[model samples]
Target: MLPVAAQQNLPVATAQTQNIKRIPLQRFEVPGTAYETVIGIAEIGPNVSIGRHTHPGPESGYVIEGGFELLVEGEPPRMLKAGESYKISPHTIHDAKTGADGAKVIATYVVEKGQPLAAAVK
Candidate 1:
């Protein structure tokens, strides 16, 4: 895992309103180790997808550019436009897709130490 300082030293979104904003990134702690955090860029790319996956803990994300829709178990597809955000609890099965024009978002993942980025479901 990357060090927190190293991650912080890198350049990232810093705006606080409108087009850009700097928000608190969430981190998940393991039973007996340091926490893990998912740092996201404002506008990643168009049609970007992370595939169906699982989280060891909880995850949260906010749209920053364009828009996208999400489908989680027991829920309907939710359209999240720029400035919108959502959170997923640990072990939730889900997948994400970028908007037609592409979308950018800031996502914070709380995962246990040594957890896979995501566990693909069959």
Candidate 2:
């Protein structure tokens, strides 16, 4: 994930905000283990939200840019900004919401091989 400070360097945007984009960066199998590692960047457009979802395994993430409110099921929502990192347990449902400017995050998942990275929550 890129940081919001980096976004400030870009040209100003129009009134309308952009949508969330998930760009996979890399993936590799963990030798001697049943897990694989997947790394990707999530570009959350301003005023947008990624609906509630759950990972096949644990998720380790870093906020590189902008800011967002993380709504983890059964927990109070919290605001996270650049330079911060977070961990989500396997199968925990959660959602991410952004302010007017949006946020960028880089995340890594250590999941069972051949399983989908994430599943949508009802």
Highest-TM-score candidate: 2
Q: RMSD to native for every prediction?
A: 8.1, 7.6
lDDT of 2 by residue, 9-102 (tens): 2222233224755676878899999998878787888887676777778988999999999889989999999999888899898878889878
Q: In model 1, what is the error at residue 56, expressed in angstroms?
A: 0.6
Error of 2 at 61 (Å): 0.7
RMSD of 1: 8.1
**lDDT of each prediction vs. the true structure?**
0.60, 0.75
Segments of candidate 2 deviating more than 4 angstroms: 1-18
- In candidate 1, the residue pairs with backbone N, CA or C atoms under 3 Å apart (3 or more residues apart, or in different chains) clash, namely 15-21, 28-110, 46-102, 57-90
How many residue pairs clash (N, CA or C atoms closer than 3 angstroms) in each of the candidate models, in the order given? Answer: 4, 6
lDDT of 1 by residue, 1-122 (tens): 11242243222223312332334444445456666776555453455554566667687877767887787887898888988988988888886666567666777766556655456654
